[model samples]
Target: MTLDFSVVTDVWQSLVYGTLGTLFLAVAGMIIATIIGVLGVAILRTHMVIPSFLVTAFVEVIRNTPFLVQIYFIFFALPLAGVRLNPTMTAVLALGLNGGAYAIEIIRGGVESIPKGQTEAGLALGLHNHEVFRMIVLKPALRAIYPSLSSQFILLTLTTAICTSISAYELTSVGQRIEAETFRSFETYFTLTGIYLVISMVTMWTLAAIGRRAFNYPQR
Candidate 1:
């Protein structure tokens, strides 16, 4: 059988829409994950034992479980408890929680790497604890872990493909529909693979640029 590239032309619009949906999911997820990561780190750093323990448990549970199971729980199990979310919202929430769990550890490692003197110095300089954390600790720690964070985010974007499992209308789901309608599974999936690759590369470059601008510091 001869391979035909013409099939893609017929479904290009669907593919574009699918790609945009994927980007929306990933961007929304990352924003939520970043907030969770910051809060989780703060909770863990506090002297309050219960909150720390709760955050730790959350991190452990999310990081250890399969992402697919987590998403399934959010999308299917929640509605049974009187909480209903659309597919896109469910996907974003699941991805955020999963990525946030990992981010907690990443950010914690970065924070821990800082010297004790820095925190003390910030405190001595009339900065409140929260102020010190935000101005001194969080920014520097994020810089230290920016690469790891960015890579994690890229992984999160790739994981958006899993949203297709819940009929989230992402790239893979669109590809599947096109494949069924066009009877071109090979061509459809092959094109999808390339599209995903391009997304990943573009995401990485964009993150690198953000890092340079946000964390611009003179290297010693």
Candidate 2:
């Protein structure tokens, strides 16, 4: 049997919007994830019993759950509590919370890898503790975790496809509509897979560029 990508090709404009939507969800989610990751690590380091325990609990819960169930809960279950978020917002929130959990641990590992001497050196340099953390610790720690963080973010981007289940406007959702209308299941999903592969590559390239710019310190 021959393939017919023409079904997908007939609606290129919808595909563009779908791809844009995916990027929007991924970018917004990554922003939230980074914020949560950084904040979670900071709170955990403070070792305040209550805050630390809450952060730990969040990490454990999110890390252990299925992402599909999490998204469904945010979209379907929260409305019962008067927390009504549209599908788009719910999808972004789900993706962010999911990625943030992993980010917390990834960043913590990087922070722990820094030698204590570096902190001592920063302190001796007449810098405030906060300044030392920002200037000396944060950058190096980010450099150490850059690879892992980038990979996680890439996975997060791919996860946006699952948002289709919630009717969030993403690449896979668009493909589903096309498939339903065209009755081209094989062609629709095959092209969807190709599009997703492109997205993954683009995301990987963008992350690599960011890492280079942010951590391009001279190697000793």
Candidate 3:
């Protein structure tokens, strides 16, 4: 068969739309993951209540298990418990929870890396505990962990392909659909691999730029 640039034009719109879906899944999950990471680490550090133990167990289990199993549990088991989430929601929840578990360790390491003297200095300055954490600790800690956190988010974006098992129809799912329709499995998947590589590289570069801008302050 002759090479067809024509096929690229034909499929460009579908690829763009599929990428949008993938971005939706990735960005939504990243937001939830950030919330969970912040709260989970805070709870673990503070040990507020029984929920702290639950969060500890939750983080451990999510970190240890495959995200595919987590997705299956969210999609399969929740309905049995009379709580049904849509496919996209299930994908986002699974990805978010999994990413959050990993992020907890990254953030915790960042937080713990702050010298005890720093915290003491903040206390001496008469800053409240929360204010100290917010002002003196968080930015430095994040600067330390930004690379790992950004990698986790980019990986989570690639893993959005797994949502196709439940019919979420993000990028990979759309590629599969196109391959089925056009009987161009090799070409379709090859194009998808290229697409994913481009997107992931762009994401990583953007994150690095953001990190540099945000964390460029002089260190003591």
lDDT of each: 0.93, 0.92, 0.87
lDDT of 3 by residue, 100-196 (tens): 8888888988999999899899999999988888788878899889999999999999989999999986999889888788777667887899999
CA error at residue 95 for candidate 2, angstroms: 0.8
lDDT of 2 by residue, 1-45 (tens): 788889989998999999999999999999999999998988887
| Model 3 poorest 10 in a row by lDDT | 1-10
Off by over 4 Å in 1: none
> Alpha carbon lDDT of residue 166, candidate 2?
90
The local distance difference test score of model 2 is 0.92
Q: Cα deviation of 58 in candidate 1 (Å)?
A: 0.8
Give the C-alpha miss distance for residue 3 in model 1, angstroms: 0.6
Candidate 1: deviation at residue 38, Å? 0.7
Q: What's the TM-score of every candidate structure?
A: 0.98, 0.96, 0.93
